[model samples]
Target: MFSPALLQMILVAALLSLLSAGKLTASDYYVATTGNDQNPGTLNQPFRTVARGISSARQPGDNVIVRKGIYPQARTLNLANPGTADNYISLKAFEEEEVIIDGSNLQKDATLIAVLSHHIRIQGLTVRNSQNIGISIWGPGTRVHAVEVSGNRVHHCQNSGIYAGFNRLHDPVRDLLIEDNVISECSLMNEGGRYNQWSFGAGAGLSRKVTIRNNTVSHCYGEGIGLYLSNKGTIEGNTVHDNFSVNIYLDNTTNTRVSRNLVYSTEDQRFYRFNHPASGIQIANENYQGFNNPSSHNVITNNILIGNYIAISSGSYQRGGGLKHTLIANNTAWGSIGPLLHIDADTSHYKSRISNNIFKQTGNVPLTDIQGSTARIEFSNNLWHGGVPQQSARSTSDLEADPQLINGGSFNPEAYRLSESSPAHNAGIKLPEVEQDFNGKPRSKNFDIGAW
Candidate 1:
């Protein structure tokens, strides 16, 4: 056998030869509106259409970089090519240039961008005016995994802004990272259309190990951000507001954590007057046909909710599956029009723990309206104030007094922070799962009562 040094040199030479022959190297394809598809996809000679550039990027680590321009597609931009576990194919705007994918000319019910494969990264693209979903990352009858959709602006879609799911339960989508996206003005077609008012700003269903964080979602027809039939998902640090229905909804989800989110509705109820009431967060089991998953083992903590019809709720909408083993803690809710927490009567298998929350109301509305059996629920160490006929009897350790939050009556999220001398400071029972406050500060051994 050859020496080790000689063998390394030979291997390096072979790799150099392969790269020189364009055999083992990733490629970058460019698209520009002023170019033509017949030209080579390069910086100077770029493809005219985004489809041409994406089609040319057929290998792992390939990038389809679109220049600053508006490319209106008459059909869906189907990203069917996949990368490997170690390498990801990316479709992104070129070097901070604005690339708008306008789907105004597309056929009805067609999505703007359809990610049909795995190990894909779609970033920094503005997608708008689609008849259906703006960006849909799903595979029909197949499983899609390891997709990252970040820093995109998706708006004016007739349906959901961004969605990832498959109808088949066994072929669930997995490992999605959707973060730092601004999604608004979606679900425009839900106004008495074929969709039946079921659109949202951004949502994922039938998926696992999904992280949706730091997104701003607003003014949608349905829930701002929803997770349905999904498990092991984290919905964190999202600013969701002014949606028609629930701002953040967990339907038929298990082992999900919704934390540190800012959810609220405007005082005028801008888009909320159309359909469902303005709810900050809702956990339910809708029991869609063939999917009987229940909402269980979920944690909602460190969130700030303001001016919603209901701050947080749990229920069984279809009367089949129900919420169980839920933990609602370390949240601050204020200025709710109705009861801050509402539990439906038909909720089967209802068992939850509510603690370290600040439920403050401005009117005579009760802090909670529990129509279900409350025997299984444990309510403790919460601060309740400004509601008539308070529900303090349920918890022996609960305090009925002003939380003394900084500017507590304001709609600003920072206004709910606990002051130095506030009664809520260091008054909460320690929850092991909640190690940080709403502002991402580490909680001390002596915990605070509400989100700070």
Candidate 2:
């Protein structure tokens, strides 16, 4: 005989199973290659246009599924609706399907997808071959928040691959996530979009709490990744290469963290003719307008820079232009030119901390401090080799020893790491940010000089 308590427990388990399996209340609308826009958005008889599917999603828990095909729309797909915290409007490719949103026929300056609202997710699609940005999100008239752009292939765009929050008179975007996207071949070739200066591969201007992670950005005529005035953001685990101006640029940003990213340079010789040098990372305050916000409280750590003209630059030359309280640590810089590390400013209050970094130059004057005529710089525990050899700034801990790395005289990615027998090992100043090496290996308690 079964006990009454045991039967009650069995009945409760069965009721919970029914509620968990049948709890889905959201609808899934489909868009296909062979369907008409006049059809109801069902699985078999779906809508043809992506815009039609978006219009038919009546609630926040609705999803718009696009099938595998070439969507050759020439106009912008504007997402103007908002979703709640529990539910978001998702526009994505069908399961394991290859959906290509080809914007080859779009007019110049016409963006492909513009998300003007919050709680939207765009993923697993190919958005490419456009005249302007592949995807953009902004609330020009008001504030927008919580956007996720991931797992997409954006390429061959004439301007930026993915741009955010660069409009005029707009409230800054908050809580943005851009990750695992392959963005390349954004040719900013002076087509009236960027006449004076070119666009970026992926970037945001006037945003906060943004995260850019694990993306591959290459072959850009402008900077690879630029965050202008984007505060409290993090750039991590991205590979940025083959850019014209600088691989990564932070202009007038505050409280930003850049870490574990690989930045290298490529020569096209076009920038040389225009009197521009290929730089790796630059933090400046030259482009601010009425808002004269300083670049402060930013940290750059555990990066690998190879084959660049300048490894990293800080501060500025104009009046009231400089960085304050920035930290640069645990990076490997190999094969650069023209003062591989330069910090120049016209003010005395420019302050920066450079530590535990490896600077191996291609015979360039690796550094010029102040150019410290007046700036406050704290540089220490770094390894320097083979530059034009400028007089280094004063530091408590300095090492001119040869960093015994593998292929130590070349531009290989592993060339700047410390060998077991290297003098740089266990000879660096201990910094809080130097907890890891370039490969994310934990540093020793005694510390190893330079980025491993």
Candidate 3:
């Protein structure tokens, strides 16, 4: 004898099941030669192509772990579906091998690889040789977290190797972690098309709230780490070398910290058949007339800037310069084409604390610190390694004596032991340290010489 209450409970249970079934389920997909698309996408019965596997995956917590092989897609592998809060979709490599997603689409002129969906995680895959951007994230106002792109290689892409931001100007992609990925062999070009007519090569747009750490980025056509409207992000522990353009470019950003990154350019591997040099750590203002979107509240500290055109350049144009409140300290820049410190700001509102850095130039025109009427460019405790200083009638105060390094004008980590006779041994300002020691150790004594 079933009671009325029992019947009501059964009805509620059935309704709950219906609602739960509508949500995306946790399913796995494999990719191998001997696989089955018809069967359930399990380890044994894997799908052939990445597009097929990704399409069949349900939303929220649905994951596709591509095994070791080359997977080709007709168009971009679009992960634009909205995932639930609990169930986030993940596309990752099975064993961190050469899991290649070959995006050599000959039919299309340029493929815009956009990850427009929500709560997506992609890790450990080599995305290479695309006509457009290699791996991009266009998630608007969505939390994209724990995207571990480690131990993979990206090369010979036309556009940027890694891009994380929304397509729109205001909204930005947030909470991305790009670590230990080797990005090289990319060519930068000004392809006139849908891609914001003002786009440069590899490093040419806005990235936000992301951490680009410990990766070796080199041999690109544009900047090393391009902060286009990117803010509150930390870029450290990375080696950016051998790019055609600027190394670390900050445009229309604020509250970002770029510390301890080794930025320089070697003889370019020649992605394109051209011959031109580049700069290192170039910062400039964007939107000259319309928007006063200057990259404000940024800190450049403890970096090793070596062998480039210009070590660091502040402000965009010669007259239109008033980008203010930047901190440049404890950096060691050697063998540059232009001045070690070139500030083209117009006003004293361009306040900066330039302290305890080693500026060594092989060329004649050395440190050029342009002091405007309103600009208070505090020069304190900086060790002039070599070259004649740029003598200006404007006040450049507290310039320190030479803190001779053991190995003059050359960087060798093995012989980089701080000599007791060196003035730079303990000559750093006692500010809050942004980065740690070489082997991820704690840096307690104020700060180190350069980015460890």
Candidate 4:
């Protein structure tokens, strides 16, 4: 027994719930190499091209499942349909089969896959051989959000392997997840005359709340993973190596966490004769076009950096904004050609902290090359071994002893693990930011000095 108005409200709520449930009920559209475009996009009668399958998936919770084969296209695969927050439109390979989106026939500057809409999931596909970018998630007029690009293999691109950005200052893209993908041999167009200097293996700029994790990025012409002008991002559990420039670069990024990453370079010579050797991690302010945004309040912890020109470099010579309030803690740096940690003079007034790190180098190279102001930088409880002693005066609790790594010469992460009687065991001050080790193990109450 209800009043007329209450009954009316109940009826409306029931109708809205029914519509929402209808939105969540998904339809599957299939694409096969031998099928025809005029088909109904079903399992037996699939669409011939990926574009037709994408066009058929028009509603929320719809899936465009491409079967096993190489589908070469001359035009870019555009994902322009927007889905709801709860029901994402998915473009994925079918049943764990192989699906390659080849862009070898496209123009030199044509991108392979362009994600122009929000709430889309692209997964389990191999994208390669684009003269430009392999996958690009960007929109000049609209703000893209909730785009997940995962479990893909992208390589041999002339420019960036994967890129996402927006140019507008206030209308930045949001909520991007790039994980468990493999990107290599990207930025291949980087030569002296026609080099695309702004390329990377995987990059995201002008975005917020981004998570890039567990990806293997290697052998790129530029930075392995670059985050520029992005805020509140997490770069974790990534293995980045052998890039021409820096391995992991944070340019004008704030409140970002770079942790549990393995960054290294095996190349003895510079990729370009005019360019400097590769660095493990570079935190700088490039100040592209006078943006002047400071790369501040960042946390770099629990990483293994090996055999780079410089393991960790802060500040830039470009003369834009400077590094401020960065915390570098609980990391292992070994076998660097130059200084293990190089802090430039540009970071004069900032209050940065370096603690609980294991800095070791061979030969006459200095452990740290702090060139500029050091009045505000804090150094404490670091285990230093084998290098010209440059940090002894700055830190009182620093130990000059053998870290006794298990196999110090190898490139494996387990090789940097501390031995049973190593001096780096329980030799760190407690820092709240580092709750886990390099392998994602929980840190003990008595924290270890380096990443283990």
Candidate 5:
């Protein structure tokens, strides 16, 4: 038998052999504004342009650290190299410095940074001023999975600030994470042009397990954060506001979860004459030629929808699309001119549940919740301000008393906490799927009526 030290030496020799053969070897390349491409991409002699770093030879676990400066040469930080799952190709700003990749003058392409490969991590940078998309991720040839686009500021784009789309059903951009980023002032060209696909803060297309969380997406011309033909992901803990269209939109999605998001002010100030919809949250069959597919098996929970044109809605086209096994629970909505919850579909056979939500409208608009026939309506324990149980209402367990909300008339919408003496303090039926309250706190022994 070989000795333990001898065995370890043999393994180390094998690893060194692989490194010498360039299979397990990874490099650290640097880029700076004062660098020269002719120099070796080291700390002292870095590459001048992002394209030069992209053109360099890189293996898995390689890093391209960009220094702090304005990269005037608008170029595509293309990911042509694939990384391993354990060790990804990292493209990050130097020590959390401000690395601005400005694409204002670039006319060659619509996207600034393009992710064509797999297992890439792009973080801690500012991507802005593109004609179309600020950062575009497309799995063109093979499957591009496990990409993390985090801690960056993506804004001021024409169509979408960040668009991750994969048309190939087999090879898709799956297992993606877009978190903790500020995406604002996007979709400048497509203001209220929903049919034109003009503007969106962030969008995911034809992907699975793509989480969009802990981000601030606001002031866009289209949806603040949209999932088009995408399914099975969590859109949670996001502050989404002030979009021309829906603040958070899910089109043709299945088994999706949207929880603990602060969605407010989906007001179309740009094209008010065009009469944009501007719903706070929409789960529907629209966009991307996917209007007819079944948008079912979804959950919208623990969201705070405030001061929007419409709080929540689900729309179906003429092609007979609808929702099934959907749940809208524990949300807080106020100051909406339209219906608090409007669900319309072509088919009468729908199964949806609305429970433990708060509906308080300051305006005189009628407080109505739509339900189609054959819908398993569970509208119970909802706290409505100045609301009376009507004959047309379905839930007999609902309460028509004041919720006793706090500081709702103030400038800060986050002050909609339930008062200690409020009727909404502990009046909800807690679902097993909903473990945390809207404030991410542990639910009390008796759950609250609406989102905290």
Candidate 6:
């Protein structure tokens, strides 16, 4: 036998040779449209259907590029193949906004489904009008990167525009980047398949490292984005609006950052409906199912929480366990009929860090912890307007004063400010700086009054 160093050199040489000689060529693949399946699936002599392309993709690095045009087929493209990290199976749009995957005529109880594939990217296509979810990523560890799902307009589907979760077999679906996609007008009732509205607009289970950003998720039957049992993902810089549920729901999740998102119309401030369907963001324990632990150490900061009943809610639906060490900071909320922040529920002692928020309300108490536990929801320096007290509780040091805003009460609907004679103009408690005002200036003091 050869020496170990010689074996290593031989392996490296073989890898380099494969990288150089086994490179993929675009001209070697075929095209599939509607008509004759007997044709040689080349670009010039293309086959008639997508079914033939699947039969032809027998190798690991083989590609079958779906050309741009209206594909009227209503069948689910179940790719029974796997691609490697180097050679991936690509089913991309021939041209941006020019290719369409029409699922309009799917039979009753017939949903278009893609299943059991690996290392595949569905790029730049309009997948819409189905009985269930328009696009379902069923494979475990599938990477859906840089696909423009705009003007595709998935509607009237019983489920979601694009739903990603675990399969019935409990396979893992992780490391998915759902970006620049538009998923709207999908039904989110109690009855659905595989993925449900109860978890996420699309939910994930026991998965980590998912980034869902820069998408417009509106007018759905469920929440804009619901995360259950998801850990360490960035749900940032997205516009989630007009869903029946919370703009973002975090249940039994942890180490997730929700920032720089615009969530609006989450509340109806009408008198009769006051606190009935009150709109606000919620981070609850979710009844403490035996499967997962309670949510902890979540950083909810630097977002605009406006036109809702309660801006932020912490430690809800706690049975016996406690929600510990959640950071609710750097958020601005206005026009709340109920308390701007409420952390009162049936649970044992809980620990939460409530600090540095901007609350503008109609005399709605800014901070409230009705649990009456000895370890109250901690608070430091938060800005409040409209004569609302900082905390309605009897223990905490509630600062009831003007927060000397730049535009005064005229600019703030709740009329929050530090009067020329008041000391709270810049006299805020010392804290770390996270956000600045509209004028790009840091909080003149160490703490900013409201969510910028």
- Pick the winner on lDDT between candidates 2 and 5: 5
lDDT of 2: 0.77
Q: Give the lDDT of residue 369 in candidate 1.
A: 80
**Per-residue lDDT over 1-452 for candidate 6, one digit per residue giving the tens place of the 0 to 100 score:** 98999999999999999998986453335555553578777777776666577667766666665676667656776666666667666555555435666667776534554635666555566766666667666545544322222233344556666666553213346666667776666654433222344423444454565566767666666656766666776676666665554667777777877766666563332211223332457776665344564677677776666555566765555442454767777666665646666665545435666666666565544444345452545766666566545333322433555545445323232333334554344434554535444223466554544554
Lowest summed lDDT window (length 10), candidate 5: 386-395
Which residue pairs show collisions in model 2? 369-372
The residue-level lDDT of candidate 6 at 185 comes to 63
Q: How big is the positional error of residue 245 in model 3, measured in Å on the Cα after superposition?
A: 1.9
TM-score of each: 0.92, 0.87, 0.85, 0.92, 0.90, 0.73
Residue 173 in candidate 6 has what lDDT? 62
Q: What would the per-residue lDDT of candidate 3 be over residues 9-93, giving only the tens digit for each residue?
A: 9999999999998764577777765576776678878887787778876667788888887776557777765556577677778
Q: Output the worst ten-in-a-row residue range by lDDT, candidate 3.
A: 191-200
lDDT of 4 by residue, 286-321 (tens): 757845457889999999999888999986677544
lDDT of 5 by residue, 1-452 (tens): 99999999999999999888875567888999999999899989999987787667378898888999998545656787888888899888999689999988877446788888888999998998887788887884355778889999988887788778777544557888899999998887765455565446877877778899999998887788888677787899999887876889888777889999988764546633246447888877654552333578899999988877778887775433665788888998887757776766356436667888998878777676555553444567787774543344446667778788887754254678888888887788877767888879888778888887
Q: What local lDDT does model 6 show for residue 296?
A: 75
When superposed on Cα atoms, how far off is each prediction in RMSD? Answer: 4.2, 7.0, 3.9, 3.9, 4.6, 6.7
Question: Model 2, which residues run further than 4 Å from truth?
Answer: 1-24, 140-142, 166-170, 187-197, 270-277, 315-320, 348-351, 364-375, 392-396, 408-415
lDDT values of the candidates? 0.86, 0.77, 0.65, 0.86, 0.78, 0.57
Q: What ranges in model 5 sit over 4 Å off?
A: 1-24, 140-142, 192-195, 266-268, 271-277, 287-293, 369-374, 387-392, 410-414
Model 4 residue 186 lDDT score: 89
